[model samples]
Target: MPTPIKLSSRNDYESFLEKFDTFLLDCDGVLWHGNTLLPGVREVLALLRQKGKRLIFVTNNSAKSRASYSLKFKKLNIEVNENEIFCSAYIAAYYLKNILKFPKEKKIYVIGESGITEELDLEGIRSCGSSEDDDGKDFDFNDIHPDPTVGAVLCGLDTRINYKKIAKAFNYLYSNPDCLFLLTNDDSTIPYNGTLYPGTGSLVAPLIKSLNRNPDAVMGKPNKPMMDCITNEFQLDVERTCMIGDRLNTDIQFGINGKLKTLLVLTGISKEHDILIKNAPIVPDYYLPSLGDFSELCK
Candidate 1:
């Protein structure tokens, strides 16, 4: 087992600066909590950009479109482009259209926001069952009419998750053996606006239990689809690329799964001591109090 290396001293930080050329970062916890930007995150990003580092923002949140996410960055006075941002929604769409070769005529039953539908639309993919109609309705469990046109069922964070959606998704997966069932990200919990809430996993749990079938794919951190998307798009040297995130299971494990070095930050979900405990789920290569601590190297 590889123990985490704490970069405490100036020499340690400087040595790390020479080591990595690219960075993969998580957006919610590692960069900011909800909409508020963490202290020195801007500086750290600016410094890394100035130092010619390739920075990629990888997030599992399937709520916001890349354009909207970029607007949030612009609102915070951070320089960003749509290309640098990678979200689960985009990858889910990509995986379905490209990897799975899902037919264009077939529609997806989506239990998510427009962030997902927008990406699917970009690929000429159609979707139905958004919160507008599918969510919050009562399910009688008897005359459940599953949409035969729905060739796939995709789940993400639906704030209004209810019986109707579950019944439909469950029936689609249970009845249609050829129907693809996927999740943008199965994060059991998520941090948003400085609070924890049940994530996509929780919303999809009922359907999973009722259908008794696992999703064909989970397009998020700690998974191969996300790694495949990035590695295929960019030429990243596995040893030189580092993934920095706040969560242990999703983010740190994501790096480990990709065979890239990892860095855990304490500013979000995981505590400093969480990684030090024996038999940790996934230990990072290096850690600091926060990503902003890397600003020290800018000097």
Candidate 2:
């Protein structure tokens, strides 16, 4: 197994950052936690843009669509466009259509939030049930039939998930071993109002755990789909692009998988002591106190 390359000093990190003209950033943890921006994040972004760096905000949170995320960023005073943002919903839709070889018109039962539905519509993938008639009605579990022609189970963040939906997914997955199970991300919970709230990962994880079914694929960070999307959309070489984020499991793993330089900032989930713990698969190429430290490097 390959070990993580560690940069113990600031100079080592600067050397790595100097080579990259394009940056793939994780939004929630790296730039800000919740609604607040990390110190010096704006300045660093501004400086990068001023220096003509190509920056792409890549996120696995499929609860919101790209357009929604773009609007949020603009409200947060970050100058971002829709093209610069790529979410797991978009990636999942693409993977189902092109990678898993699911037909574009294949009808799928999506037990997910609006973002997932929007992405499917964008890709021209048809949903199995409901129109304006079932707008506010709960998802009907009976609608999922155990037909061999049933393409796949596309799981996203469903806030209204219940035992019936989980049972349907489990039954379908059990019956059709070849049927694809595409998950957006595995984040258990998201921080909300100084407390933790169930995220999409939390909702889907139980179904996977109960049925003992690993996903056919996931289309988020640390997975190849998001990385492929970044490369195709940004036209960036993996060697020259850097991924900076605050999570070990997602952001750092994405860099490790993609073979890009990774920077772990302390403003988010993973902390300093977590790095010292040996046998962690998700390790950063460089560690900083925060994004503020990155600003100092730019100076």
Candidate 3:
């Protein structure tokens, strides 16, 4: 019912910050591109902290765990705690362990990175398929087999993804129809070091197509589980929280799904015109060229 507001005026910008005490931010594009921090964005974060606002980093990236994310924050000279960071890998493990009560005896067949493995370990769940599984040899039909003990197949981005990995996942899902199919996120691509690389979704597409089975849960932006992890822990009020990110499909949709206010930043996947299109799937409560723009208000 309400219209989207672009915060270009001084009064609008200040008012936007004042309206919410909690800020949920996306990592890759809104805060930094790859390892490089966006200009003036750090100052904006410091300003938010000075205002005593709650800051949570929500990312679809399942490549790293909380500790890894914290290490990155430390590297960037950004102040963020492990508890304040929420990633799809962490949430997937949490959901399976806490909510689903996944059996301890069974193992999760992981088609992901170290992040998923680490998170599952913290949750006391065993898993198979790590870098060690990449033997680099072509998978033979006679040699391929799925572990009967695999209760779930967890998918995420694998930089070294190859046909062998897909074959293993496909066999696992095909053989064990009851096994839960979970995805860390459906982010089609990730921009890094000035190049767009195929993301987790792209890596998992082959399996999805061959198996003809959709993931039972996608644990990332726009998905309820990721937000639930933070909301349940912090007791945050959706009415007073703001979800900020560059992509409308995930970040903005996550806000809308949770009934929280949304802020769209133009530094990442989506642009100004994307949100203005006719019959747009999602529209944020506010928009800005980048979070860096708010650095002016920090002064």
Candidate 4:
């Protein structure tokens, strides 16, 4: 358990910036709060780009696809390439298509948003449910009809998650032992616009409790599978990379577990005192009041 150094001054930023050739940034807390961009974020990002740092916007939010995330960058007036974004939805699709070698004849039953289907489509894989099941239909045991073609049940952050989707997903995994159960991210809560809301883990809690099983794979932060996907695709030198985020458990732990440097920001869930809690499970290598502190380096 290493103590985290606070980064504040310009020299601190300069020294910190020199250590990492690549930066993996978490979206929700460090960069923005919902649709609003944080202070000095755009400037610091520009500076990082100017210095030729490889910036990859890694997010556990699976409600949006890569394309959708790119659009969000555009909306924020942030100049980011679509290739620079890696959302859990994209990771899930990559894992299914490349790692699992998901069969062509089989389709995935999605318990998320359109992002899951969008990414799956990009991989030439078929997915059912999601928006199709967003009619708020009530779940009925008599309506249960498992589709043999459905080989997996993929769950993510679904704002429209209902009993119908959970019941249907439950039946698929329950009836077919071969049906793979996957979660884009088991995040219990998400930070948005200065508040926390139920995340993917909350939505998937019902199925997990009912079936007495966890996902075969959780494709997000603090998980090795997602880290493996990024490393294999980018061919990054872990020593020259750093993961920056607001949370201790997911973002910082992801970096630590992946053997990369970790930086904690205070714009989101975990405050500075969290690292001092008794028996804290994870601690970041460095801490900053806000990533905006790096803006002085650009000046």
Global lDDT scores for all candidate models: 0.87, 0.76, 0.89, 0.91
- Candidate 3, which segments miss by more than 4 Å at Cα? none
lDDT by residue (tens digit), candidate 2, 212-271: 878777888888988887776667777788898878888888888998877787777888
- lDDT, residue 288, model 2: 72
Error of 2 at 201 (Å): 3.4
Per-candidate TM-score against the hidden true structure: 0.95, 0.84, 0.97, 0.97
Per-residue lDDT of model 1, residues 17-86, tens digit only: 7789999999987888877888889998998889899999999999987887889899989888788888
Which should have the higher TM-score, number 2 or number 3?
Answer: 3
Q: Candidates 1 and 2: which is better by lDDT?
A: 1
lDDT of candidate 1 at residue 205, scale 0 to 100? 87
Q: Which has the better TM-score: candidate 1, or candidate 3?
A: 3
The 10-residue segment of model 4 with minimum total lDDT is 135-144
Candidate with maximal lDDT: 4
Q: 279, model 1: CA deviation in Å?
A: 2.1
Worst 10 residues of 1 by lDDT: 131-140
Quality of model 1 by C-alpha lDDT: 0.87
Cα lDDT for residue 92, model 4? 96
